[model samples]
Target: MKKIKLLKIFLPNSLEETYSKILNNPFKIGAPNGFEPIKISESYACAKFIEEVISKELIIDPFGNTEEVTSKRYIINEFTISRIRNDHILILENPSRSVRELIRKLSEILGTRFYASAIQIDIHALSEFLSNNRDSIHLKNTRALLSGVNLDKGSSATIEITSLKDAIHDARYHFKGKTFKIERARFTASSGTKKSTIEVRSTGLISVHGPDEKSLVELINMFIAEGLS
Candidate 1:
């Protein structure tokens, strides 16, 4: 017999509890790769189906960041399943653009309503900023500032990496009169995950991993916003 499972891709670490709750719903539907939604609720059965359908473990690697690989393993942390009458209401946390698009498309086809958020920013301008300031200690200080603010206000910033050639070019041409050169740039969001570190290279790239694609896109968008602002 064919196996069945629930495969949900959410923005990394964004809606932890919300997704966990959704996973608990016995009546929740399952759709693989945009296929028709299937209803199932048994965690054990779902686990078996997931094992059979997805050969490798669900691991999201962005920008080749090794830290994400070393972090915690993926497992159902906590959940609760229940149902409500017509007077009942369901609430979901904010989601990324891609996630929203997928959900919207699914709802449209299925004749239902789904909601998601699409965070936006400019990658090119941010890249230009990092490229121009390769030697500026201020860039590092900016990271420190943002990191401190995250600690205080509880938020994240997005970042990017660049190649050495690009860094040098920006430093020589774009930031000729500037006293500082930025060696790297990174964007991130943190919620009490201590001792987080990001490394930006000269290739004009930034790397991080989300629990899902939506989270990854949100992280990238966050970095762009911070870099430009």
Candidate 2:
């Protein structure tokens, strides 16, 4: 499995303005080669959109009733973009092909003229695989589990980052050597100052485990400033 997320930075704008632009001048973004153009909007989760709008052939039964699409779609190289909240949320989930092209398209549509932030790249490694091939990836500075299935056990590293794009670039570079299938990767754009925003994004993954809120914020800052190197 593979995940791709992008965070587009911009000066503060009203939700109304953002919403109006999306509704009036809708834009199409890059997607997996055979997939449809990435749709940008202010409503609908990825799964719901697929079930209601995309072809039935493209939709598959989710692993759980919780709305998560099954992993089978990965083989076909599909992708989805979730609803965006202009203040600080732009999500691209399960981009199975042409990650670079997709990002470029998004950058063009979103307009880089607005100060954009680093692209955050997140990849989840199957715990079992990490256990079997510890030497493949360098997550040496292990910390306590922050999020994910086994909250008490899963661990990750605090790879510093100067920007999300560079960090993700470096992550992809390392991901090549590990050979472990990626479970998820996300790109986020935000003011990291917002607790609600961060919480919404950290719904999964054993994130940077810190001793306290201040420390956790520091870790996120480091991540956005430098790619996990």
Candidate 3:
């Protein structure tokens, strides 16, 4: 089964001039490869603020950067995306490229200070049954896995996992009384990304947080390699 995971690196306050350059000069900054800039907005109380998503196509090592373009969407973090809390976060949504490769590339572009905090990885894996056998699945499993459970499009469940192999099992145990056809599941802690059509489908998500940067990298590597094994 193909899984979708997110790695968000929180950074310090961006230099105003740098932020401005990203917002204003997107074309020169580039994107992952074919992705174009989409306008992003922040919400507070009742007001909304629009901010340009500074972006550029990144070239993965071994492959290097390519001028060849395709329509497939993959938006890498050009700069950090800010939440209302004023925390600047560099978010890689449903990234398929190597996280380490991305980090190196971003460092070249934005410098190391941009990744001021430990990296946060949100692990996601949806059942093969979801897209393959939607009609036959039970509502209980649907609600248990997906937020705002609906027959149509909706939000995904964000739950953390301690063990990737037992993700579905954990979910079943956690939501024991809930009716569902799925046999396993897992969840993560609370946390939070943008644009592009990168879809992260999971019955549960494992969210990593805290200040321990060393352990954080280990956990990220573990999940990336063994999460789906």
Pick the TM-score winner: 3
Q: Write the per-residue lDDT of candidate 3 for residues 1-229, one digit (tens) a residue.
A: 2233333444433445334434443432334321224445541111111222433554555767556333443334332243424333344433443456445544545556656333322322343322233342221121223232122244334444344344455655665555434322332211122111112233222223333323333333344333323
* Model 2 root-mean-square deviation: 16.5
What is the per-residue lDDT of model 1 for residues 90-144, given as tens digits with 9 covering 90 to 100? Answer: 1122212123333443344323333333222233355445434433212221231
Name the candidate, 1 or 3, with the larger TM-score value.
3
The TM-score values for the models, in the order shown, are 0.23, 0.27, 0.32
lDDT, residue 196, candidate 1: 28
Q: Write the number of the candidate with greater TM-score, choosing between 2 and 3.
A: 3
In model 1, the runs with Cα more than 4 Å from the true position are: 1-24, 27-111, 123-196, 199-229
Stretches of candidate 3 off by over 4 Å are 1-4, 15-18, 23-36, 40-80, 84-86, 116-229
Off by over 4 Å in 2: 1-8, 26-87, 99-112, 119-229
| Model 2 Cα lDDT, one tens digit per residue, 1-229 | 2233445445334434433333443323322322233343454212111111232333335664334343322223233332334234334454333345444433443466434344533333222222233242222211112222221235534333333333334544654443232333332322233321122133222232222334333344334334323
Model 3 scores worst on lDDT over the 10 consecutive residues at 43-52
Candidate number with the higher lDDT (2 or 3): 3
lDDT of 2 at 151: 18
